[model samples]
Target: MTAHEERPNEPILLRRDEGGIATLTLNRPQQFNSLSMAMLEALIGAIDDIARDESVRAVVIAGEGKAFCAGHDLKEMRSSHALAFHQQLFRLCGRFMMKLTEIPQPVIARVHSIATAAGCQLVSMCDLAVASENARFAVSGINVGLFCATPSVGLSRNVGRKEAFEMLVTGDFIDAREAQRRGLVNRVVPPDELDAEVERLCASILAKSPLAIRMGKQMFYKQLEMGLDAAYQLASETMACNMMCEDAGEGIDAFVAKRKPEFRGR
Candidate 1:
């Protein structure tokens, strides 16, 4: 976004696969891994691809360099100051955030250094986040005279309104420990241990029945927007359907037989 343009030969997002875990690392380290238009497009494409790839049971979003994402490409916005461009840019970003939840497999964020503005949204958008103890977080666009309205949507959902508002309005940074205390992140570990902790969480989910995880993820997000009675109705139906799946049947049978459940992903 700055004078330094994204080189045609350089990747904005890098993908690595292992044991069904997809690790997507934002690749523009020189820009603090900011989400430039190209990076956003790459991420959106990757998300869509992962949605269709049943083999990828879990996804980890991480950054390649000193810091996690610093939010949108500020330089790009300055270069292209039209309302039409702004609208499309924001729509695309918001859609990608929503897509993170819509995907079947759980998304885990490996956070470090600073995650601000849309970067903060990235952490909040994740199903779970494991932050390095020294990591910092903030929805800091307000400091630059821009309100983090979009980031606040995800931030408010993760933390309390008062806490979220304090960060948004003040542009204050929270350490990983504080983030965990406020529910912004699930765990905080020594910086060197971040990867191990993320993998531990991934393995925990990997051991579960994929069918149960997929259906539960759907029911979980849907219930959040429902009235109490409606939520209960939907959850009950989902549970019934889940129990009818072969994985559930096998799980119960395995329990009765005193053995680990062998999930067929049915």
Candidate 2:
């Protein structure tokens, strides 16, 4: 049974925090955690809250139940045959995907099962992704006669243009290992090891200086959109500013003195 079928009153999105990681679980299990309008709104709100929270050093987006996510709620879309509604829905989804990159903390996708169409787009938009060996990915909207235009935006950015276009047109699923090889995910482990792997990735990010992570994340995405010379100029300026931070100085001193650095997040 889907999460909604089991508990109709439960929140469609659930947030839990432990250590420095904030995990957002998509809660529509019966619907395969499809991105309905309400789900999109809840995610945007949670992401906005996390963006301002200095304590949240990292985020993991996961889905509850059988699938990570199955893309848009087709039932909901069919419920409203209005063009304006469809336009609004895609616009909201695009905004949420963009926010994942804009946030200071790194967002990692925890894909336990299938992630298709907009669901695949979610994985692509995240800073990193760790999937189970049993996981599958696809942008399969073409199967239903609709092109996954918005999903293609993130898909193209993550993988080669030809590879992404092939998926768009074929509506074929790629296994976890293949997805990793194609640059869609960072790691693929056994199903039983999924949680452990995600936590391990999170631990690595949490060990870094928070200020450096924040600054580096912002600079990272910004530089990706710039020309080579402009990108270097921005990177140089960022490095100079980062070097002036107290954490940077302490890190260098500790490295030379053979001691661990205690970063105050300045």
Using TM-score as the measure, the top candidate is 1
TM-scores, all models, native as reference: 0.97, 0.97
Per model, how many backbone clashes are there? Answer: 0, 2
For model 2, residues 1-266, the per-residue Cα lDDT tens digits are 12233356898888999998999999998899999988898899999999999999999999999999999999999999899999999999999999999999999999999999999999999999999999999999999999999999999999999999999999999999999999999999999999999999999998889999999999999999999999999999999999999999999999999998899899
Q: Can you give the lDDT of residue 22 in candidate 1?
A: 96
lDDT of 1: 0.93
lDDT by residue (1-266, candidate 1, tens digit) is: 11224576777788889999999999899899998777788888999999999999999999989998899989998988799999999999999999999999999999978999999999999999999998999999999999999999999999999999999999999999999999999999999898999999999999999999999999999999999999999999999999999999999999999999999999
Best by lDDT: 2
Off by over 4 Å in 1: 1-5
Off by over 4 Å in 2: 1-8
Q: Assess the local accuracy of residue 218 in candidate 2 as a C-alpha lDDT between 0 and 100.
A: 98
